[model samples]
Target: MADPNWLDERELTAWKQFLSTGAAINRLVDQQLKRDAGLSHQQYEVLARLAEAPEGRLRMTDLAGAAVTSKSGLTYQVGQLEKAGLVRRCGCAGDERGIVAALTEAGWQKLREAAPEHAALVRDLFVDGMSRKDFAAFAAGLAALHDRLNPPAI
Candidate 1:
């Protein structure tokens, strides 16, 4: 009884393909955003989250978690966005220690402008590139993986 956990050729190929494709998708999406919208993918994510939040605002801490960025990185991004007139930061209501990022009107407009093109690029680069049947299977597999490993918090 030594080790039974080992990936065969198929498993190894699948793993490598997932890693490379995921990175490539991110890179292409980022490039498109930068070229078409003058925004980076991370910046787009920050703006998107803010735009969807109630009153287009979210706490910095909450945003950091949602955007999956470190505190310092979020701070830096927010500052950059502020300079670009895409977002504004303010003191959180009733919380001296809390800061909130709010989507500016300009930011909302920018998002509206960028969304269609970004979506098209995503569809062309990712969705359209996969067969519908394969897409469904991949989606199912991902959902199962997520559900098993990261179930919702009670």
Candidate 2:
């Protein structure tokens, strides 16, 4: 078929580069998290989100949103963490139907221990490679793209 509103050479090249670099970055981050924390990147993210909450606890629905994962996927991952004694599920006091996922003491300790190494890896593999000005520009552009793609829920 003939090209119709197809990407020109420059656009195609840029798209390919963006995809390749993004994949590489994802792999590096996941590997670093696994190596330094005995945690997958997703698991680390879940713990970090919980840690930032007021009481290191969030509703399972909120946790799933924060993790940007499906409910079933979040349930499976949280199950693994629960099995590892990294977090526990508690019933929400105000909502009998709601369950909260809270980071366990062991989870906090593991995250604390892995913090430095994780930061170092992120810096060395990603942030350090970008100049401050360029990084800011990239972040702004990414934020715009994300907002455009995902508007807030009504």
TM-score against truth, every candidate: 0.90, 0.90
Regions of candidate 2 where Cα sits further than 4 Å from its true position:
1-4
**What does candidate 2's lDDT look like per residue over 36-92, in tens digits?**
788988888888889999889999999999898899989988999999999999999
Judge candidate 1 against the unseen true structure and give its global Cα lDDT, from 0 to 1. Answer: 0.92
In model 1, what lDDT does residue 90 have?
Answer: 95
For model 2, name the residue pairs that clash. Answer: none
Per-residue alpha-carbon lDDT of candidate 1 for residues 1-154, written as tens digits (9 for 90 to 100): 8988999999999999999998999999999999999999999999988887999999999999888799999999899899999999999989999999999999999999999999899899878888999999988999999889867879
